[model samples]
Every structure is written in structure tokens, then in C-alpha cells.
Target: MSELCRLWHVTVTVAGEEVEPLIVRNALRRLSDQRPFLHSLKYAGGRAEIQYWEEAESLLDASSLALRVWNEHRESAGLPRWEVVGLEVLERTVFLSRGMEYHVIVDLHDVTPLPF
Candidate 1:
């Protein structure tokens, strides 16, 4: 039996040329360091966005982490602060028919938490 694990997907957007991939990666690392509950670091699109998984016990906890990362970058002047535009339990099952991988569907919880 496959073990059921809670996962979270985080998407961060920054200008193509203005943002450095290393810096963004560092930021994600910092976030993960600060909160050890998350795992996996998959970066894509010229440092434009990143997605990772987290052991989210609830939507609120997951949302908090997302908000923190966004604010941290904004506070550090890493990127123009973008509000929590959207978040929700990702319902659709994503699969790569021709790849060495397996995919898991997560409960996407959309959150537009008020800025702190």
C-alpha cells in the first residue's frame, strides 16, 4: 500500500531578468530552513517560479508558510511583493506517462491571507 503523505505546492513569481535564480533558491532554502516541515525543491522557468512539497497538517498551516516566504522576499527586497493571488487543494491528478516518476494529487487550499 502506498503511504499517503500531505504535500504542498508553492509558486513564486519574479521578473525574468531582474531576479537571480541563486538568490531565489537561497530564499527557498531559507524558508525551508526556517520551517523544516517542507521538502523537495523544484525550480523552473529561469528562476521565475518554484514548487515544493510540504507536510501540511492543515490549509491554515500551509498558507502561513506561503505567506511568510512571500513577505520575507518582499521585506528583503528580493522581489516585488505579490499578494497571495490564489491557493487551493489541487484536485486533478498529474501524471507523466513517459517519465521516470510518479505523481500525487494534493488538496489545493486557496488562501489570500491578509498581509502582516
Candidate 2:
């Protein structure tokens, strides 16, 4: 099968509980810096948005990379580990478009005591 290249809108959300917007913004910035693929990083409706190119050898690889980013960010950030309930990476591709779209959601719940 031929490899397909597409543009992706990667998103990570820390939802379920109220968090200071400033904190989220700072975390997003740091996350962006950790991931070189992200560009034009922004936030909307409590979600971190980034424009990236899914140029990995396979779609699975691309998705895996997104997951890794989420895990890494969560581990590094002073956030509850169990608070994260979901991590989603959706494809928002347009027909006949040169690249496919991607959206990732990292859901978080209320703060909890760190077990580690």
C-alpha cells in the first residue's frame, strides 16, 4: 500500500475538572516545545491545538507518536496520573486533500494523590 501524507490537527485536553487556564496554557507551551512536530500551537475551549504533518512511515506510527507525547507530557507535568481518563487521536481528513487531519484528546479527571 502506498503511504499517505496529510496535515493533522493534534489536540490534547485536560478535562473533567476545572483547572486554571494559565496553568494549562503554560503546560501546552511546554508540551509544544517537547514535540517538534507541533506548529501553530493554540488553545480553544480548554483544548490544546497544534498543526502537524503526519509523515510517519505508517498511520499507526503517527498515532503512537501522539500517544507518547501525551504520556510524556502527563508524566512531566505536575498533574495527577490517574486523572487522565482518555487520550484520543482523531483523523480529520478532507477528501482529495494532500494531507489528512488529526485531532488528539487527552482527557483528565480530578486531582488525585500521586502514588509514586
Candidate 3:
């Protein structure tokens, strides 16, 4: 039988040696270009948070991919060599149930790197 796929909302936080704010912003922009499916991107000199949705067969699969995102795109996006400091993965139903106050609706057309 084929495994069922589920939608997961993932938030990954990474941190590393400090760099200039502009550099971090530019790097995040590049990441957005490469990963347009990302819902939002926010960054500071030494840290960043990436939010997106992942379709996977299991939570573990989703978490594994989320953990690899930073390292996988580091060179292409010119991202800092950061380590994953936090990770949150919630099922779609659970995420939406958290209510509007906890959600940030992001329009791709209006997307710009946000500072955290």
C-alpha cells in the first residue's frame, strides 16, 4: 500500500557567528528565490527563522527534511554556516487550530525579507 502523505507546518530556527544585517537579509532573499514555497523568512545578524509547509509520509520525515534545509541550501543561497537551534513541526489541522492571532498571512507578491 502507498503511504499517505500529510501536510506539516515547519518552523526552523538557526544561529551562528554574527554577520552584517544586510548580508543576512540578502542571503535570505536568495533562499526565498530558491525555495519560493516558503511562507515567510525572518532574520537577524546571527539568527534566522524559516517557516514553510512540508508534505511527507510521517512526522519524522518532515522533521528530517526541515533539519536539513539550512545545510542543503547554504552554499547556493550564500547562507551563514549556522546550526539548527530550534524546530517546530505541526500537522496542518493543529497549526490552523492555533487561530488567527498566531498566524502571519504572507503574500508572495509582497514578500520582503523580514527582521526578527
Which candidate ranks first by lDDT, i.e. highest?
Answer: 3
Give one digit per residue, the lDDT tens place, for model 1 in 1-116: 12444554544433343345556555555555554544333332243333345446655675676656556655553443344444443311331333313332231221111122
lDDT of 3 by residue, 4-53 (tens): 99988998999999988789888888899999888778888888888888
Report the CA-based lDDT of candidate 3 relative to the real structure.
Answer: 0.84
TM-score of each: 0.39, 0.51, 0.88
Off by over 4 Å in 1: 1-17, 44-69, 72-80, 90-116
Each prediction's Cα RMSD? 9.9, 9.2, 2.6
Consecutive 10-residue window with the lowest summed lDDT within model 2: 107-116
Which stretch of 10 consecutive residues in model 3 shows the poorest summed lDDT? 107-116
Candidates in order have lDDT scores of: 0.43, 0.46, 0.84
lDDT of 2: 0.46
Itemize residue pairs with steric clashes in candidate 2: 6-99, 6-100, 8-102
TM-score of 3: 0.88
Pick by TM-score: 2 or 3, better one: 3
